[model samples]
Each structure stands twice: as structure tokens, then as C-alpha cells.
Target: MNNYKEKQLEKSAEHYAKKVFKVIAAIVFGAIVFGLAIYVLMRLWNWLTPELWGWSTLTYWQALGLFVLAKIIFGFGGEGACKPKKGKKNKKKWKMKCDMRNDFSDWKLYDEFWTVEGEAAFKRYIENHKKRHHENEQKQS
Candidate 1:
């Protein structure tokens, strides 16, 4: 009975190990394919934009700089092209407060000017307004 249990445990362990290996293999394969696609795209872009690629206009170092800049601007990997190092402060601080109109018609002017915190504030304001309105209706009834 002990021998059977040990064999079953070993089989289970081997099955889990195979799963882990498969996952790692898939991740590596995905990375390689993604890298190849990026390389192909960059090559095509360079070929098409001859003015942006010439040695006189952009040396090796300049080309690298431009590539880095483009990556920063476009956010190639979705979240950001490059992650900031630990302990490094982000230099760009968005202005939180702006001249926001109190009237509902002018709400559109402030639509793009809000931070996440500001959005929460606005939502809370709306909720409070609705609650007050409901309370007033209850009092009237």
C-alpha cells in the first residue's frame, strides 16, 4: 500500500513538473516571437523612412537616441516603454486644480482636466446631490 501511494505521489509530482515546464516554454516562445515582430517592424520603418535613417542625419548613437525617444513617446509596451528605477521620482506632475465652472453646461470644459482623485470627488458630489434630492422628495411626500 505504501509503495502504491509513493508511486502515485511521484506521478503527480512529475505531472506538475511537466506543466511548469510547458508554461515556461510557452512564455519563452512568446517572448521570442514578440521580439522578432518588433525587429521586423523597426526594420521596415527604417527602410521606409530613409531620411530618418541616414548616417549623416543620424549616427548610430543618434539613431539609438531617437529609437528610445520614440519608445518613450509612443509607450510601445502599453504600460510604458520603460519602467522607472526603484526610488526614482517621476518628474512630470499633472496640475490637479483648474478653473472649473460651477454650472453643468461648462462641465465639458473640465472633462479632460481631472485626475483620478478629482474624478472620485466629482462622483461623490453627484451622489450627494442625488441623495439630497431624494430626501427633499421624501419630505414633500
Candidate 2:
């Protein structure tokens, strides 16, 4: 009836209001953190640069600009920068290239490989390289 409909409408309004509050809170918190970072950066630059490098000190806006520029150039690293992706067949390949882990699981048999077949392979490569160089010299002459 009418009462049931009003209750449903109230619940929906409350849910949306909570969501909007969370969004506003997040934006405000982000702004505060950003402002604090810029202030700290400006203070540090003003303290250090004038003394060490005889460089000009930065204002808050200048510090903010520099921070943005540095982020743009060096990248804005965030969460999961090195975290492995799920359901990925290339996780091993990605981990191999990531700087997070120095593990060489595949290279565990490197010594055995070198002892068994690496020397012969290297010698063959050297012989091939020498032949190629000699052929190039002959061609040039």
C-alpha cells in the first residue's frame, strides 16, 4: 500500500545518500592529502635548494607543478605495480621482467646446462662468427 511504497522510497533515498556522502568524503580526503604533499614539498625544496644548490625556492603552486611533472616523467606508480595478474599464462614471463623478485627458477639448472652443452654451443658460435668475419673481409677486399 501507500506506507509500503514510502518505506521503499526512504530506503532507496538513504542508500543513494550514503553513496554520495562516500564520494564527497573521498574527494575531500584526496584534496587534503594532495595539499599536504605540496606544502611538504615546497618546504623541503625551500629548505634544501637555497642552501645546497643555490637554486630558487619553490612556492606551493610551483611545488605542485613539479610534483605533477615528475609524476608524468617517472610515471605515477600505484597499487599492484608488481603484483602478479590472476589467470595469466604469461605470469612467469611478467615476473621474470619485474624488478620485485630476483628469483631465477628456470636458471636453477644453469650450472648443469653450462657443464653439459653450453661450452660446445659457445665454441660453435665462435667458429661461426669467425667464419662470417673472414667471409666479410674477403668480400670487402
Candidate 3:
């Protein structure tokens, strides 16, 4: 019984140590990547600006500050962004709207709408439509 408990304790300790090591390694890697990006940005800014715009080159921290500032200014859309909601009712509503918009898609059946047969059909449809409108107007009158 004591040996079993000792083995379980060792296993738990090892599991926790591995978890902690992974978290620490991820943090260190993220920091290194972020610092390298900032250095590269500063170098590019220094290489480009002075030649093209007569602007002074930026240092590492200044470039990092500019990046953060840009993110603060333009990165977040707050609430104005249209995001797709996963609700069934919203999906149904959006689908219904799309279906309504596409109700006339069947009218695009002809490659050339002014084809000879299509023109005759068009005239028949228009005459029928006008007759219905005339009847409606006469009834109203």
C-alpha cells in the first residue's frame, strides 16, 4: 500500500511539473518572438524613413509603442462589427432574407432575355399583368 501511494504521488508531481514547464516555456517563447518582431520593425522603419521621408529612425521601444498605439487606435471594432450569430432563429431569419432576395432569380433563366421566344413570352406576361392592373383600377373606380 505504501509503495502504491508513493508511485501515485510521484506521477502526480511529474504531471504538475510538466504542466508548469510547458506554461513557462510558452511564455518565454512568446516574449522572445515579440521582442524579435519589435527589433525587426525598428530596423525596417530606420532603413526606410530616413531615405524616403527625411524622418528620424525609431528605436526598439518606440516601434513597440507605435505598434501598441496603432492597435489601440484601430484594431478593436468594439460593437460596430457585424458578427455571425450561431442562434438557430438568427440563421433562419438570415436564410429567409436571402431567400426573399433571390425570389427573382428564376427570372434570369434566359441567357438573352430579348430572345425571340423570350420577347413573345415577355409581351404576353406584360399584357396579362396590365389586364390585371386594369381590372383592379376599374374595380377601384
Scored by lDDT, the top model is 2
lDDT of 3 at 24: 100
Please state the error at residue 129 of candidate 2 in Å: 3.4
Q: Which digits, one per residue and each the tens of the lDDT, describe model 2 over residues 1-141?
A: 999999999999999999999999999999999999999999999999999999999988999999999999999876455566567677767777675465668688999999999999999999999999999999999
lDDT of 2 at 102: 55
Q: For residues 1-141, write the lDDT of model 3, one tens digit per residue.
A: 999999999999999999999999999999999899899989999999999999999978899998789889888556332434555357666767767766887778666666858789989999999999999999999
Backbone clashes under 3 angstroms, per model = 0, 0, 0
Q: What range of 10 consecutive residues in model 1 has the weakest lDDT sum?
A: 93-102
Residue 89 displacement in candidate 3 (angstroms): 13
lDDT score, candidate 3: 0.85
Checking candidate 3 for backbone clashes, the offending pairs are none
Q: Of models 1 and 2, which has the larger lDDT? A: 2
For candidate 3, the TM-score is 0.55
Ten contiguous residues minimizing lDDT sum, candidate 3: 79-88
- After TM-score superposition, what is the CA distance of residue 108 in candidate 1 from its true location, in Å? 16
Candidate 1: list runs displaced more than 4 Å. 51-72, 75-141
What lDDT score goes with residue 111 in model 3? Answer: 62
